[model samples]
Target: MSTFGDLFRVHTYGESHCKSVGCIIDGCPPGLKLTEEDIQVQLSRRRPGQSDLTTARSEFDTVHLQSGTEHNVTLGTPIGLLVHNKDQRPHDYAETDLYPRPSHADYTYLAKYGIKASSGGGRASARETIGRVAAGAIAEKYLKEAAGVEIVAFVASVGKVELPFAQGEDEVLGKEFVELLRTTTREQVDKELTRCPHRETSDKIADAIRSAKSREDSLGGTIICVIRNCPLGLGEPAFDKLEAVLAHAMLSIPSTKAFEIGSGFRGTQFLGSQHNDPFVDGVDARTGQKRLRTSTNWSGGSQGGISNGEDVYFRVGFKPPATISQQQNTAKYDGSTGVLETKGRHDPCVLPRAIPIVETMAALVIMDMFLKQNARSSAASLLEPVDHLPPSMILPGKNKVVETQLVEDKVVQE
Candidate 1:
């Protein structure tokens, strides 16, 4: 579905070089503070031309809040957000119309629709993500104001140049790592071109990108995102686990090839004894109720598809941009093999541009689950005590986590 989320739905529309790209947000609460300015912060980060590491094309990407809010407040209507495409060079991609770019959506999109946008991979372009970033900015604002949740993403790897979170010979996630997660922000991440907080490693990643650019090629990397203050029991378990939805959202990004949620692949190496998130008794500040706490986060803040009140962290692997200037042998529509050289403004590495997209997609999934869980608890409360339920949904503008301390509370009270 072009739409994401059951309760907090966002239906994105338009294409890469279309006159405009936008989305319709359905089901946001009434009276929430929202404005075009709120959405622009993320669009700016996602926009190209911020530096030489990304594509050379630059557009103002100014957003027009068409409908859904008045006087800077949401009326609980379908929010309409739009961004005009001002600098589109369709001729640059005319070659793609005849011969599909290797490892790109050009072939598949044509196969599925019998026709495709002759320019820019159409919806497949990273430009299509403009609508997503816009919608996600609103989702993020709602999340922060409602639940005190903060999400941050940074470059974890650039073509095998890894950082601390992806370090080798490690204790996995230790006390020091958790401490670092608390203070990480978009600003700190932006301090470096690679968006990696580590100066030395970021330089290496930048160098790799420059080398690829020099070769008329591209490189791939991974991004690590962390969610702080996630409410307990926010996921719809079994089929729609929190991790599953998150993976779904992240993989939707262009060039995203792999996804890993806490503990990740390395956890496979650990014995059951080493991998478990052992719990302890702790009190909830809001409700004054005793709750369960985990000493470690090998579980990645989730169990059985439900959030367990730990920081939710994950990694996303992105492949290099498929459209490159180098010559390649590929078949045309009739299966005749021929050499092709692609054109257009392309990034040597997509990881830097992908950082904000990862953050936004994560927020979209989190906000979706947050609303879904709230609806469930609110419904179940008609016959049961909500105090022992997972957690109440944070009302819009509340800015405080609802009094929710469950699991242990259910055991003790029962």
Candidate 2:
């Protein structure tokens, strides 16, 4: 099942190079302002052929609302979104029948199903992420308006060229850090078609990609994401940890190799004292009210499978895309030795376009958790007025008042 979430469920369907691929979102609350334009914003970001570095497959990837929506609003029913395949060149893959492309799923898919789709990579293609992104955009709106949560992701590293981080002692990446990184990354992407903004480094990576393309090989890299203002008590402990859910979402994407959340592998280099986030009581700069907070966020805003009112950050690693144009040693299904060359258009590096997908998955997880928190708190209804009162009103303070009860005697006895 290509579905995620227990409360706000999203089920993705269809395959790459197919007639269409889409997602069905169940449990979307009614009366929320939703429109096809909202979904298209994120889709356009992930769509291929938008730039020179990406694949040349020009797909409009437009979203068509098939059901569960009217007048641009959700009807409390399952919302369906579809993206039709417009530019499929099936003839390019004719040779794949004889020699399955090395490093691709062609062989494994055949071994498992005893048959496979000849065009594109079938379900294994990155094209499937379009549905995830579309669903994510909607999820993002819900999370932001309902829970005051925000998610932002960018290409943090391309091969060896990494985006420079803001100078700070805090282990967690905050909104300022993310904004700075985004600015630098966008500038780089604009200057260089490869999406690596640092001129010298971008050139080097471009050279490597061009070299790999010439040799018929592919390259891989990593993306870092940050989520901020997530409310506390979102995820379930033990069985459904926040990190576990995020990992599941990321690994579902094609070519994803690894997933790591705050301090991740790097924390191993530090002592326990250095890695632990120290709890403190302080006045929030934005709200000017005392609240329970952490001076450092080495734990990535999650404690005991629930958010702790801090930033949540993670990194996803992708293996080099498998559809290298290079010819490689392989064999036919009948065991005849032959040379294999992959057909069809593919990105030498998939990190830039993958940015939106990462953001989308984060939105899905955050939105689902938000909905689950609401469902748990209110038994009668999931929709309720969001409490956006000042922190002092909700938190303990010197001026806080306590309710007192007076004892009264009843004349009538049992």
Candidate 3:
């Protein structure tokens, strides 16, 4: 389903090579400050053709807000935003309409619908994600204001070249590591072929892509995302857990192959004693308040499908992009096996463009949860309190009075 969320809903539409792509946000609270500029900031980050390592198609990716706001604040009405497609070369894929691009959804789409968009991947195109990113920008703003939450993601690995982990621990990488990565120049990496920041490693990766391209093949890599300062009690239980929601959102991206959180599959190697998060009460070094904490975070800030108030972090793996410029074995429309060489403007690696998409998806998931929790809490507070005096002051439901009293007390305490 295109629509997602229980309290804050978002529906994305449009396809690659279409006139435009956009989203409609149905449940954003009124009075939140938002505008086309806020959405454009993120859209530019995900736009293709920004650098040498990404695709060659260039798009201005400017956002146009259609409705649901007055002046600059949301009006508690459905918000609509659109980004027009400025550059499209549909003719590139006209010849290959009957030949599905290897590793893409082309075959599956044809198998299901019997007809597919001849240009680009159509609805399956990464272009459709523009709407998601636009809607996510607003979601991120609300989440930050409501919960003080922040999320950051980057290219953790490209091919075999992975970021160096400090002290070989699974804890969150600090600012020093971020600075180290930030200092590495794109020119230095792009100077070689592999897009690796390291000169030596990049050369190797570049050669591989060149060779793969010649052979009609592609490559894929992993991205690491870190979420910080997320409030406790954001996620739900069971099927709607934070991790599950994040995974579902992430896997929806094109070419995603795997998902991992916290220590992820690697934690399985450790015994329960080693993998357990130990709870402890300690004074906060930053806030000076006594707080409950865990010495280690193997659960990735979630336990029992709920947020544990720690950093919510995860990794997603993407396969090599389809549409390699080389000859490949495939079936023809007549049902006979044949060879074909695909031609189109494609990226050697989707990592650079994908980084923003990962962050955008995370923002959407977290923002939706934030809105749901806030709405439930607000609704619960509006209910009238009940009092009884016969023998004992008993409400119809257990803890009903206590819950009402707690809400009242909290207001007074605030």
Clashing pairs in 2: 188-197, 216-326
Among all candidates shown, the one with the greatest lDDT: 1
TM-score, cand. 1: 0.91
Model 3 ranges off by over 4 Å: 165-217, 282-289, 382-414
lDDT of 2 by residue, 1-414 (tens): 778887788888887778899999998889889888988988987889876567888888999988888888889999999999989888888888788777778889898998998878788888878878988999988776665566766565666666554345544444554454334433344456555555665677677767766666678888777787666666778878898899999999888999988767866666788778888986543334466788668788798987777778888998888777777788987899988776778887887788779988999888887776655544322334335656555334312121100000111111
> Which stretches of candidate 1 lie above 4 Å from their native place?
165-170, 173-179, 283-290, 384-414
lDDT of 3 by residue, 1-414 (tens): 788676778899987888999999898889999878888878887888776566789898999999999989999999999889989888888656667666777778788889887788988888988988888888888877755667777666667666653434543444444443435443443343333455554556556556655555667888777777665567777789999999999999888999998878867766788789898875433234455567777788898887766677788998888777777888876667888776678877877677668888998888888666655655755666444445245422322332322122223222
Cα lDDT of model 1 overall? 0.83
Per-residue alpha-carbon lDDT of candidate 1 for residues 197-249, written as tens digits (9 for 90 to 100)? 87888999999899889999899999989998787887876889999999999
| Candidate 3 least-lDDT 10 residues | 404-413
**How much lDDT does each candidate structure score?**
0.83, 0.74, 0.73
TM-score of each: 0.91, 0.84, 0.84
lDDT of 1 at 39: 93
Which runs of model 2 end up more than 4 angstroms from their true locations?
A: 164-207, 283-289, 380-414
Ranking by TM-score: 1, 2, 3
**In candidate 2, where is summed lDDT lowest over 10 consecutive residues?**
403-412
